[model samples]
Target: MSQDHDEALVRMVNQIAANLGPGREEADAAEGVCTHLEKFWARAMKRRIVACLDAPDGGLAPLARRGVERLAERQAD
Candidate 1:
């Protein structure tokens, strides 16, 4: 995806995490975001985010990073 597209995806994921995170623990919110993404996002989208996980400047929010990690772990199973 283009850089703008990637940034938009990151922002969207962060927004989901923020929306789900209110009044909840950070870890719980991240898990919720991960679950939501896994169920709703396209496989290619997930793959793209996973690819960003290791980038030096992935630009992922803390919760977004955790969500990506959770998603990756689930995919590994």
Candidate 2:
């Protein structure tokens, strides 16, 4: 997808996160969702995301890589 689509999807994901439960704390809800995403996604798309991000070698890089892997996993499954 193009950058625009990517951004839109990100926004959509954020929105999905925000709308997870029926409550006034939508922002908080989204944050919780995003947090889960970070964990799951980090493991899911570990490689592609790191390459796309051009991340340097480091321990923190796995989070990004796994996030990308998660995206792929989501697509395939």
Candidate 3:
């Protein structure tokens, strides 16, 4: 994906995480973000976001990163 696309994906996941983070435990928020991604995001989008995990400065927030990690695990299974 292009850098712009990657950045957009990062922003999107970060937004999702932020929206889900408030009023919830860390694990629950992460799970919610992961579930949203799994259920709503396209396969290509999910793969791209998960690839961001490897970028040194992917710009993903803590919750977003955790959520993406969970999504990756699900994809693996």
Q: By TM-score, who's the top model here?
A: 3
In the range 1-77, model 1's lDDT, one tens digit per residue, is 79788888888888888788889998899899999999999998998888788889988888889989999999889
TM-score for each candidate, following the candidate numbering: 0.90, 0.32, 0.97
Candidate 3 clashes between residue pairs 3 or more apart in a chain or in different chains: none
Provide the overall lDDT of each model, using Cα atoms, as 2-decimal numbers.
0.88, 0.44, 0.96
Candidate rank order under TM-score: 3, 1, 2
Stretches > 4 Å off in candidate 1: none
What is the Å distance of residue 32 in model 3 from its true position?
0.2
In Å, residue 41's CA in model 2 sits off its true spot by 1.9
Tens digits of lDDT, candidate 3, 1-77: 79999999999999999999999999999999999999999999999999999999999999999999999999999
Winner of 2 and 3 under lDDT:
3
lDDT of 3: 0.96
Among residues 3 or more apart in sequence or in different chains, the pairs in candidate 1 whose N, CA or C atoms overlap within 3 Å are none
Indicate whether candidate 1 or candidate 3 has the larger TM-score.
Answer: 3
Which candidate leads in lDDT?
A: 3
